[model samples]
Structure formats: structure tokens, C-alpha cells
Target: MKAAILLIGTELLNGAMIDTNSIYIAEQLNKYGIEIEYKIMVRDVIEEMEKAFAFAKKNVDLIITTGGLGPTDDDITKAAIAKFLKKKLVVDEKEKKELVKKYKDRKIEKKSNFKEIEKPEGAISFKNDVGMAPAVYINGIVAFPGFPNELKNMFPKFLKFYAKENNLKSKIYIKDIITCGIGESILEKRVKDIFTEDNIFYEFLVKDYGTLIRLQTKIENKKKVEKIVEKLYNKIADFIIGEDEERVETNIFKYLMAQKKPLTISTAESCTGGMIASKLVDVSGISASFKEGIVCYSNEAKIKRLKVKKETLLAHGAVSEEVAKEMVEGLKTDVAIATTGIAGPGGGTIEKPVGLVYIAVRVGESVEIIRKEFKGERNKIRQRTTLFALYSLLKMLSKRYDI
Candidate 1:
């Protein structure tokens, strides 16, 4: 089955709000062997909505819409669909009761919710479990509420309903290989052999944590798919960190978890401003390994907090590997990671340009410091710096523990 997504919102067109609904819908549809042929974003105008609808009917068999399903006057999704399908809009009695019960449960006595319960003629309206507004399945079009949480909650139910209604043959399968300690461009070149094979497809997404190689196939044989993944893994064995949904900190945390006793770790961040610590803390039960994180941005903080020598900062400047080395010395933990950088559009000279960063990793009795200069905006520079810090920590943990 082919699908098209129509995301309607003036806020999205104006850049005030981002439309994440299309991505969710496309991924969900793909799982059920539904190919998304087109994704369109239209402002809250009936003419534009009808145009999007007409285009979808010509190219796809199913249509999914998200957004503009609100109580406000600008919510014209139902009105536009009604006009396009030549169907009358009427109040869904069952949906009206759900809306009333929902309001009464919250002590709201207003009957204004009846307007929000309107549905297309002969449409199957699904009640929203998490928010106001309802999702509707009618005439080859499925409409979901614009709010992300509401749409997410209703998506699974819609999928079950779609499965019962239509018989599907193909099933989408996906495998992701997440790798770090290598550049995306270099990784792309490394995987040229995989892409060179006929009748196979791949996608490479470069992220701050790592580059993710997503492999998708509709072939019925599971062993054939496994063989493709194994070939890719063999090609990039040294660079691969983990599989789908795995992260740099996750891989490191798994290694630590395998040890007999938990090892405590600390961070001393400069331009990254505790981003490394934030990522590690995102993992649950990390308190067993992650001890503390501190952002010592100023020279005084580095000196007073992390015990960086004043003489070192004066000699090598704050953005040097020497200061990063001194910053990790004060941390009293099994391991310490420190970063100092110039992530900036300003504060740069000929000797020290923007994006110049130094990451220091200390494990047991050994310490390694790396100096790198990235090319990007301030935020990108900081993000890449944190990635290198985690990558370096992973490399050190592997060597020290032989995991």
C-alpha cells in the first residue's frame, strides 16, 4: 500500500512550530509495508488543504493527515476533507458522548465540546486517550490530532485497525549499525562496497553521537538480511560501537556494567558546558558509574574547582591540551573526562581559531589528551567536541578493561 502525509498548520509554515508528525506517520506506515510516496505541509487554508488532498489521491492509495484538528475557527481539516469527498459533516453521537464524559470527568460543564466531536459521514472516529480532539479513519484517509503525544498514543490503535481492514503482503525490516570514532565522510567511503552490490539499498545518517547505517529490505528470507548486516559489520568492525538505538555512553555503560564492581566517573567541561555529563546521565542507573559533572568555564573555576594550575593556563592558554590535562587531575574517581575548547563566532586568533577543542581522558594511571579543530557554528562545535570525548572514553575503557 502507498501512503501520503498531509501536515497542516500555519505555525509550521511560519517556522513557529515544527511538524514532527510526518516523520512518525511515515515510519509507522513503513512497518506495515506501506510506502510513503509524498509528504506535504500546507498552511491552515482550505484551498491549500484541498490541493494537497487532490495530489495525494493521484499518487497514493492512502492519505494520513496531522494537525488543524482543534476547537479553534482556523481548524479547517474536516471542512476541507468534506468538500473534497463531497460528504456532509455531522456530529458523531458516540464521539459527542466521549467528549462530554471527558469534560465532565474534569468538572467542565460546557457543551461547546460538541463542535469538537464533528466527524465525516460514515467515518470511524477514534477517541483520543491522551488529549482533546479525535482521530478519524474514513474513505482511504486517516486523520490524527496534531499534538505529538495524542498522535503517538492513537498511532498504534490506528495501525491495528489498518491491519484488520487491509491484507498486506510485504513487511518492512530495518537494521541499524551505530558507529563512532570515525568521520561520516570516511565512513561513507568505507561502506562503498556495500552499496556497490546490486538490488540492495542503504541510508547513512550522521549524528553527534555517531553515524547510523540503516539497512532496509523486504526480502522474505531472514538469513539473507542477516548476511547483509554481517557483511557491513565485517567491513566496519573497528568503527562499530553498537546497534540500533544504542549510543556512545550506552556502549561504555554496558562495559562498566559487566565489571565485578562499578567504577565511578567524573567530568570537567569547558566549552561543552557539562553536555558530556548530561548525555551520560540520560542513561538510567548510571549513578553506579557516573559520579559527578562540573562545568568550569572560566579560568578561575578551572583553578579553584578542578585544581588546574594557573601557570599552565598562562603558558598554553585556556583552550590548550595542557589545561584539559590539569582539569582532569583534581577529579577523584576511577576515570575522568575533561574538555576545553573555543566554540565560537568570536574570541579567535591566528594561532587559536574557532572550533579548536582539546579533550582529555584519564583512566587508572594513564592519561591521553587530543587536540582537534572542527569547522561549524558554535553549537555544532560543542556537540562534536562532546562526541569525541565520549568516543575517547569508550576507546580507553575498551583498552583498559579489554572488553
Candidate 2:
């Protein structure tokens, strides 16, 4: 079913607060095979909210609105929804009693203010476990508070109720493969048949260092869908590095731990700086695997720290595949990853220009080096280099363990 999300708040328009509720809601809806067609951010003004509700009612099968539900006057979601439905707001007795009991120690005047929380006519109320405002459902429009905690509690309950009422079945199975050293066009050609299949949907997302292809299959019969997914997975298994929610680093960690292998890794980063080391250390329990990192940006540091040959740096200009290989090999660890390149708006030469990165990974006694040229801003180049280093290491590990 098509869904439209309406995020109501002046704070969002002013950029004072981010609307994370939309992302969470969209992810939850996707689990049930519901697609959100449009997302609108509107101020809390009555006219704007009313106009948004009218627009959603005509175009979308279900309209989910978050924000502006509270005791304050600025909270106008309920009022606008009531006006749009032409229904009078009446206090929900159960909600009023619960609010009073929750704050029984407070004065009666404080509790009296909460009596204003009322639902529009014929609307079912969804209880909010994390906040005071209750979510109201009228027709296809489901309204919840703008507060993330309250929306988190209410939106899931609303989805559960809606799924039961409509007999909705969630049958989405997603498989993702991480591939490096390939462009999106080339990957698309390789997996064109999978996308053109009648029951499956394909999405390709390009990252800094590599590309991720996600294949989704939606079918009512679970057994048939599982078989299709298995066949597709086998067909593309050679190109696949990771699947579903498994990241390269995560998969590498799991693989290492499973093998009961103890490892120490260090880095000699030039263009990528400490980005590769930072990503590896971000995962918990990395101390068991990571040893140290060296950011050898200059020739002196490379020679002093990573012990790169001075002649190699002068000849290769510090950004060649040969130097990248030396940086990885000099680390003297179980595995070492290194990057050398020019990621910038400036620093371009006829031979060694910007966005030219060389990544090398050393596993056991074997060292593999790859030379790539990326096109983007400085930050994008750095990010891509870091991810590529991780992917190369993961690929080497996979070959060693036969995984």
C-alpha cells in the first residue's frame, strides 16, 4: 500500500530539530511491504496542517503524521485533523483517568490541564508508553506526537493494529552484496536478469569505496519466495562479499572470531589518513584484532614510522601502487591495510592527479594491491578509500578461510 508521511513542526522547517521520525516510520513500514511515496514537512499552523491532510487523503492509501500532539496551544495536529474530518473533539475518559493517576502526587490543577487531550469523533486512540500524548486514528490518517520517544512507542502499535485489520502479510526478503573495484553500470549489467525477474526488486547503492546491490523478493507464499531467494543468491554468490545486514568489517570480525584466530593489524594511511583505522576501531572488541595505526602523510613520517624506502617515495611521489604495497608490508602484523592518493580540490599533476588512490592489504605472506581513480569531492574520496581498504582485507580473509 502507498503511504505518505506528514512531519508537522515549525522546528523542522527552521532546522532547529531533525525529523528522524520519518526515517524510523519508513523503515518500519517497509518491513510490512508498505512503500512511502511522499514525505512532507509542514509547520504546526492550522491551515498548513489541514492542507497537508487534505492532500494526503486524496493521493495516498494511508497517511501517517507525526508531531504537534501535546497539551500546549502550539500542538495543533489533533485540532487540524478534527477540523478536516468535521468532528468535535471529546475528552477520552480512560486517558484522562490514566493521566490523573500517573501524576496523582501533583496538584489537581496540573491534572486538569491534561483533560484537554481528546480524540476526534470515531477515532481510535493508541496508547503512548513513553509520553503523555496519545496517538489518534481517523480513517486512513494516523496522527502521533512529534517527540521521537512517543512516536516510537505509538507508531509500531498502530502498524500492528492496521496489519491485523487489513490481513496484511509481510513477505519482503532482502539480500545485499558488497562489491569493490566495480562501477554501478557494470554491476547493473551483471545483475540485470535478477532485477527483471517478475517477483523481485533490485536497488544499487554506491558507497565511497565500493557498490552495494540489494535484491528484494516479495511474495505471498513464504516457501516459494525462499526458494527464489536461494537460487538468486547462488547465481550471484561469486560477486557477493556480504549479505543482508552484514557489513564488511562486521563479517570480517565474525570470521576471525569463529576461526579462533588472534590478529594484530596496523595501518600506514596517506590520503585516507586515519579513516580506515577509525572505522575498524568503531566496532566493539576490536582491541583483540587491531594493534596500531600510523598516519604517514609526509615522506619523513613514512620513512621514520612505517619504514618506507626514501628512494621509493621520491620516485613514486608518495601516491603510487608501489608505495602503497610497501606501506602495508612494512606494518609487520598478521594483516595490514594501507592507502595512498591525492583527495582534494587542488594538487593535480599530469600523471598523478587527484582522486587516484592505491589500496593494499597484506594477509599472512601474500600482499594484494589495487589502483583506482574516483571522482568526487575530497571527503568522498577519503571515505571511498577507507571502505575499499576494508573490503580488500575482507576478500583476502575469505580466500584464506575458504568462507
TM-score of each: 0.77, 0.69
RMSD of 2: 6.7
**lDDT of the candidates, in the order given:** 0.84, 0.80
Question: Candidate 2 lDDT, tens digit per residue, 291-371?
Answer: 898999998988888878999988877888878888888898888998999998899787877899999999878999999
- Return the TM-score for candidate 2, rounded to 2 decimals: 0.69
Write candidate 1's Cα lDDT for 349-394 as tens digits: 8999999999999987689999999999999999989988888888
Model 2 global lDDT (CA atoms, 0 to 1): 0.80
Best lDDT goes to which candidate?
Answer: 1
Instruction: Indicate which candidate wins on TM-score.
Output: 1
